[model samples]
Target chain A: MHNDIASLINSSVPGANASVVNPPEDGAGDSSVLVDSSKIYEVCEFLKTNDKFPFPVLQVISGVDYVEYFEVCYMLASFNLENSYQLILKTQLKDRENPELQSVVPVWAAANYQERECYDMIGVRFKDHPDHRRILCPDDWEGFPLRKDYEVQKVYRGMEVNPEAKMNFEDREFEVRKKEMEADLLKRQLERGH
Target chain B: MQTWDMGIKELQDETQDESMNTELLTVNMGPQHPATHGVLRVEIKTDSEIVAQAIPHIGYLHRCMEKHCESIDYRGIIPFVDRMDYLAAMNQELVYSMAVEKMLGTEVPRRAQVIRMIVSELQRIASHLMAFGTYALDLGAFSPFLYAFDEREKILRFFEEISGARLLYNYFWIGGVWNDMTNAHVSYIKDFLDNFEGELEKYDTLVSSNKIFLERVNNVGVLSVEDCFNYGATGPVLRGSGYKWDLRKVEPYLLYDEVKFDVPVGTGERGSTIGDCYNRYIVRMKEMEESVKIIRQCLDMLEPGPVIGKVSKVIKLPKGEIFYRQECPRGELGIHIVSTGEKTPYRVKVKSPCFTHVSMLPFMAPGQMVADFVATIGSIDIVLGEVDR
Candidate 1:
């Protein structure tokens, strides 16, 4: 499956530096191929539309920040093929600050929200993406929260950014309430005994 | 008398002409509305009553689950996974645990696999019941909602007995389940399954065959096979388009290959072509019966053995990435994890099914009636918790 996908990507997409990589010993069932970030869209389009490697469903697009660089992984599965085959296509981005890649939404409409999520979390910009915006965060929110160096803001709007506000209850108050309840129970038991 | 009749006819003609010149109206459906199922806001453009277009705006329930995964260890993420799709928390826990297990190259015990199958199937039934009841409520039927919830509450009782939680069960661990199921709980599930068919029959008579229900759902919000693929719609929504693309049959995970069950597809039995709202409803109804079949087989094959596998307490994954796909109740729940030989995951991306379903709303909602819009949203069976996460 890996070789077939590699050959298909090589033959169909010009200037796409694609190569099939040997599966890691602990890697799950499917094999993966490393493709250039610029030609990811072309390779994906060919794989999705080609007869031999018809990976119709784009399952997921996950972005990972690896300190030195960034990697975007695409999990693709086929429904039209004989036995369903899963394929992984990884593209590396060297520029971590303004990472950019071609969008595959024109090939698979499912990429619309997933790409936006990648951008929102990892700060990867997909060129030519329609309706590109922060999906899970507010429009006015600051830095990408998923990045390793992202620091929580002290305040947003006029409210303080305290994590304690999100807690269900404070420890001291809960302890005090428990003591009060125990005392009341002891008084009731003594009265009943009398 | 003739002059009076002419005057009334002329007034009627003028009113008809005015009604014909309709203006487009934009309406907001959610972010707080009960019919949307959760905090989903759909900006719908309509010409009087027919929707010209509908754009869904999500993120009201965004909890930044992926970001949290980066800080928490593999074992600590199960509770967070349960919160993603609160309706099918078992299945959510199963997929996350399975992914982490795959990354660690650990083998799950046979007993644990069987138990996972049983619990996951039960969760499927419970999730479908929620979808069924809520879909009925969306269509203005009040009785079926009560009837469906009555059955669902019984399933929750069974889950509570086994996992000690009614809704969000963080029971499924990375190597195996949190605890073993007793004979008493097994028998309770068996008894529930035995009586479930009768309840389903009652629902069919009350809602499925009712004329008003049929009129509201039939031939409304149709999705073509091409459209389903383009939009990446899965589970019942894709099955409703007459595609036999079930992950259980196609890419059998866990012990799904051992189970005998049918994949129900849309046959256009409700006087409409395949992929309509009615077909999606019927597919879910049929799927519940198949889930019962699977659960019965699992119960027969279940044996007494160790539930949790032998693994290190502190899980340190090798440097690699893997994408695990499970046939979740709503659709294909894919978990993509990237590890850097660390205790915590480098990146964890959950490809939630409802998120894709919500994305397809813009494509499905145009040219549909404003009232049918509710039926369309319900037919897709999206939980906003999953979508926003």
Candidate 2:
């Protein structure tokens, strides 16, 4: 797969290198790919158009923000080749006010909503989206909720957002954990067929 | 309880873009319409019968599952995930669990993989049943809807026996499943398969090959293969457009690589030139048969073994990040988990296919009749829960 990808990239595009990023074994290629964000569109175009990998399908596009930088991943699948490939394009949206990224809508029409969502949640703005509006949230909604720094919400659109919204982790706290344990004990007591 | 008449008129006025003198008719199809499986309001702008634009106004059923996912225990979040794409509950759970498993580096048991295959295919049949039923309803054919429901009920009954709930069953666990498949479950599934082929023929006669249904759907809302790819269409929607990109076959997760099943793709001028509502419907109807074939192979391979792999009850995953995805009935349902070597995931991101699927609406909905827009939407099969989540 590595040789095929490298040869494919080398043949299709100039100065394109597709090294094997075996992260689990080496963990070196895990954090970042040695590829330019600007080159993503070109590579994608090549993948979709060229003979090597006519990956006509952009299956899923998602993002993960790690405080300092954001990791925007694109999973591309090929219909003709019958193979799947992941293109993790790294982009840093430094400022929260206007986090902008190049829109892949031109590359894959399916990207309009995924980009809008990345905008709505992580606040990454796609520069050339046809209708880049607040999708999940109301039009005038305040901040991107998915970012690590932003507060979840105490109030959203005048509704009282959960007061414990900020520190609301999925796991139970000690007090609630104790109560659940007690409830389980009581249930077990009631279930005894004496 | 606000009436729709005033809303409809105001919607019409807005459709005219007020500034433009052209009288644009605005019509509200749902929020109560039967064709809209749930409370989905489609604000359509039209001149005569031709729809100029269609804007899907959702969030009526928005419980904010993303917020809920953030607040609940990663494991406990499965049931809510199940609710998002209710038709593809098993697939939803599979994607979520795969993310958690990848983050933790916890390998699932082989037995569990077989079980996952079984449930996922079952859910596929059930989800296709929904598409078939809803597509029928869109075409003003109520009988096919009932027929589809009858088959879907059999699958749901099997789910009820296995998971202890029918609609929103969180049967798949993080490392494995809640429980093993019972003998009764297997037997019922086999019986359903035996009767389904005959029933499917009824569907062909009732709706699929019906002249009215084909006339309503064929050459209507045509989405090309490029359009499907660009828009990130998945499942039957993508397949219906002549792209044979099934995640089960391409990605080969679980025991799918071992399984023998065909990715039945749409063909001909209707499939090529007119990848329309009927194409998607026909593709899904054919997909149900493929799913049935996959399920039979999975069931035959099924044997008694420990369903859950060896993992601590309080799972403290390694500090790592992994993105896991599955070919959900909707599209590629992905779950990205960033672990901090704690019981809870540091950050969990769900990439719902419906989110991307609905995004294509603004692109697909123009120039078709308002009724055809409903049919196209139904053909695409967007679950609002998954869309909003």
User: Which candidate has the highest TM-score of all?
Assistant: 1
DockQ of 1: 0.35
Model 1 per-residue lDDT tens digits across residues B1-389: 33222322343354477655556688999889878999999999876566778888889999999888887788889999999999999999999898888877789999999999999999999999999999999988888888889999998998888889999988999899989999988899899999998988988889888899999888888898888888888899999999988888887888999888999999998586799999999999999999999999999988999999988967988777778888888999998887767888888889899999999888887767778889999999999999988
Question: Per-prediction TM-score, please?
Answer: 0.90, 0.83
How far residue B23's Cα lies from its native spot in candidate 1, in Å, is 3.7
The per-residue C-alpha lDDT of model 2 at residue B355 equals: 70
DockQ of each: 0.35, 0.30
How do the residues B1-389 of candidate 2 rate in per-residue lDDT, one tens digit apiece? 22221333454565566565456689887878877677777888776666777787766776666655654567778888888887788889888888777656678888899989988888988998988888788778888889889999988988888889998888999889988888888888899998998888889888877878877787766778777767777777778787788878887889989989888777744322447777777878888888888889988998888898866766666665666677887777877666666556666667778777776777777767667777778888888778776
Best by DockQ: 1
TM-score of 2: 0.83
lDDT at position A88, candidate 2:
42
For candidate 2, the C-alpha RMSD (Å) to the true structure equals: 7.2
Stretches of candidate 2 off by over 4 Å are A1-56, A152-194, B1-22, B269-274
